[model samples]
Target: MFQYYCGLRSGVKPNPSSKRSSFAHKISRFLKCCIYFFMSCIVFHGIIVLYGAPLIESVLETFLFAVLLSTFTTLNCLCMLGPNIQAWIRVFSKNGAMSIWDNSLQITTMCSIVGAWLGAFPIPLDWDRPWQVWPISCSLGATFGYVAGLIIAPLWIYWNRKQLTYKSR
Candidate 1:
């Protein structure tokens, strides 16, 4: 699982040429993920505030929601792709070519966004459940969406596996 999350697609051994290289690669990946995670947290907080989430009224809640949403949306991608911008663009750009990992990431992202949107629906209703608090529903929605994506994306990719392979031009 650790190897899978670190973007290792195969069971091949780490480059045995040098232990230093392996350690350095791990350190670099960690730093990159940390930087991206913090940046995403800040950006998501601002967007939530701007979306009429009560900047002063529920600041901490809003920030927490942002963190939660960011975790669902960005952490997985960072774990899988490790801040590679080209890989991000290629996977998200609606390109015809996509490996199973790429497809899973894209689907997960889409589901998270859609889940957050759907989670907002209960806010205005009269049910008045405890979970109706600002951002909570959305957070739950995004998490559920992420889980759904995790389950569905692989199966969908498996079903369409043949179509995903294409010869490089």
Candidate 2:
């Protein structure tokens, strides 16, 4: 199990295919996640600009919020997938085999995103607190949602993976 990610301890070398299971492969996924996170922020910014959201703050502040939001967004994006999404992406570009993620993963991910979005609801209420500022409440909500989803998804996956559904006349 450990060898899958860490590879050999000493002078032993690793094979090319085994590289996918290496530790570096798993951790490096974060780089792609960061890109997705940034894109998520960009979309949020576009909404803020177009609708003139009440959340008024400096660019840096908003960007901070975006970063936080992106952190979880990337997390949710990566949580579910058949193969390392990065690997799947590579295959897609090169026209190789396709990896399909099950519905459970998608369900888990959407729940995470929904959780983060719902985080914004607190800001509109009359509660008085420094963290109640624009993006702060929303970001908190997002984080909370992501955590909740992360905790619950395994159970969902466990239960879901066992069922086989069919429709017949």
Candidate 3:
């Protein structure tokens, strides 16, 4: 089922002529998605560390946070855009004009980042709650933001679906 959804996002139309070929294609795409997911996790981990996440003091938490953030952004984006760097660039770096898919990616990415940023706020506060630990609050915030994006992006696209016209550059 997940594979089917991924295939749809990556524009893998069903080939009525060959079930064997279709199965092979889906397996290959699924593998590619897994690879991209893990690679993005590592990249996000390094990025988080650079952004002041602890390396020596709390490696596990940092890595877990990376996984959480990656799940929100990288995994979701991969499912939407596949492994095509060109598609990523087109959606992420091009003009504001976008298809529903591109807009969804942008919204999800922004929400996750903002969520993580906002999550860090309580860390320095003197609230002294158990959830105030380094990345706990941030993770919760990111998760909430991601959920919000998932909800809002669709509604936003639906509300504006007719107004925007996306052209391939």
Candidate 4:
């Protein structure tokens, strides 16, 4: 049992002279995929928000919210999935893995969504009538988003550490 546990942690040698699991390669690939996906999403979202069709500004705002929600949900699911994937890799490739962060990001994201919805000002996009609505709406929306992220980030970090400590015990 101890040897198996050690094997899972240390993993198998890569080459006859090197020590690294094939699982490490898979993990690197997965990380790369995630980075690519995240970057692409950022680029696409930025383009839609900044330079979308003039008439579609309102639609873009809503679509942005939906995309953010989906991303948050997906990341939350990944936190849960990590442990299972680690277990599978441990068995198949004799490599142990653990996720560093808990699923506290989900909570922060929910809180941010609620804050945005209930903020004193609402988000809007009116490119045609900039003087009429765009400035005020964008100002308020950006302020709300910034404040929400600030508040949620610390709480998330604290909650994550607390959960990790509790689980460790």
Best by TM-score: 1
Cα error, residue 75 of model 2, in Å, equals 4.9
RMSD of each candidate?
5.1, 7.3, 5.7, 9.7
Per-residue CA lDDT of candidate 1, range 1-169, in tens? 8876444568665565555777888899899889989999999999878777888989899889888888988998898888887877887886733677888888898898788878888988899899998988889888888889888898988887777765232
The 10-residue segment with the lowest total lDDT in model 2: 160-169
- Count of backbone clashes, every candidate in sequence: 0, 3, 0, 0
What would the per-residue lDDT of candidate 4 be over residues 74-121, giving only the tens digit for each residue?
Answer: 444444454244443442342122233333443444454454344413
**lDDT of candidate 3 over 16-99, digit per residue (tens):** 656677778889998988998888889989998998888999999999999999999988788888887788888888564367
Tell me the spans in candidate 2 whose CA falls farther than 4 Å from its real position.
Answer: 1-37, 48-56, 75-105, 164-169
lDDT for each candidate structure: 0.83, 0.58, 0.85, 0.47
lDDT of 3: 0.85
Candidates, ranked, lDDT: 3, 1, 2, 4
Task: Name the Cα RMSD for model 4.
Answer: 9.7
TM-scores of the models, in the given order?
Answer: 0.81, 0.55, 0.79, 0.37
Model 1 CA lDDT for position 15: 60
Predicted model with the maximum lDDT = 3
Preferred candidate (TM-score higher): 1 or 3: 1
Candidate 4 — what's its lDDT?
0.47
lDDT of 2 by residue, 36-105 (tens): 6667778766665454444555666666766665555444445543226664354334323232233334
- Residue 55 in candidate 4, Cα distance off native in Å: 13
Cα shift from native, residue 165, model 4 (Å)? 2.7
